[model samples]
Target: MTTTAPMKRRAILAFMLDRPGVLNKIAMLIRRKMYNVETLTVCKTTQPGTSRMTITLREDSDDKMRQVIKQIEKSTEVISARELDMNESFWREVAIVKLEADEGRLETLKRTYPFETLDSQGNGCFIVQVTGTSQLIDDFLKDAGSDSIIDVARSGFTAMEK
Candidate 1:
């Protein structure tokens, strides 16, 4: 008999916490399990003294992922932890890129990509900002072309499932 390894899928975990180091502890727990994080985003919740952590992990088994979620929820600082379904989630990411372009090219770029010009230096460096889905940002970068890119800064991702 032959068996195949489980295919890896992306899982997002939202952690509701009331104290500090919870993020570190959660990450350490996952690290101890040898799972790699693809993207992690943390922010203060609207409720005071509580925060939310949005973590994306690449895992093969749903059961194992659930177990990890349980571990996170078991922590003293974590009030609750749950998986966010991608299908029912609203997600967003922001990216700022600096590229080499002139007045004409910048105009063309502004029209082509959903990016705003932050500043256009006299030295031919144009800084642009974009915010949207991860896929949309990636597609913009891919189509933006690499040769002109001088630098890039991206805010990982944040999501809420509806």
Candidate 2:
């Protein structure tokens, strides 16, 4: 009989040179290592030619995480790569969901989920935006009901340790 280790989620933050194809290269590296990523967010940093990337991945052991970090940091474009814990961090994701309903039903939605108006197409269709943790956004979607959902656009997790 074979026993397999449990897969756990880990967040890795990388500060790298901001250049075209950097994200693609990093993703390819992870894939080459036979690992899959959960969510990845990349944005420019305060430095003129630098960017910060937060990657969520699932791995069976911490040793693999260290290997991935080493491979990432070895890249000329990558300045640093480190693992972070979400439990002691600040992170958020944004989602835009469209709900279809009459003004009365809209009130129910507003009360049920606190979202800002993104657009109102009229004829009982509207787009609303929610910005918060991924869990919070997911909870809002659950309470809003799938039947009422017209569309959904979500951003992945972006984070920093406190």
**Top model by TM-score, which number?**
2
TM values, all candidates: 0.87, 0.89
- Candidate number with greatest lDDT: 2
In candidate 2, the residue pairs with backbone N, CA or C atoms under 3 Å apart (3 or more residues apart, or in different chains) clash, namely none
lDDT of 1 by residue, 33-73 (tens): 88887778888888888888888777767889888888887
Backbone clashes in model 1, listed as residue pairs: none
Q: Model 1: residues >4 Å from true position, as ranges? A: 1-9
The superposed Cα distance between candidate 2 and the true structure at residue 137, in angstroms, equals 1.2
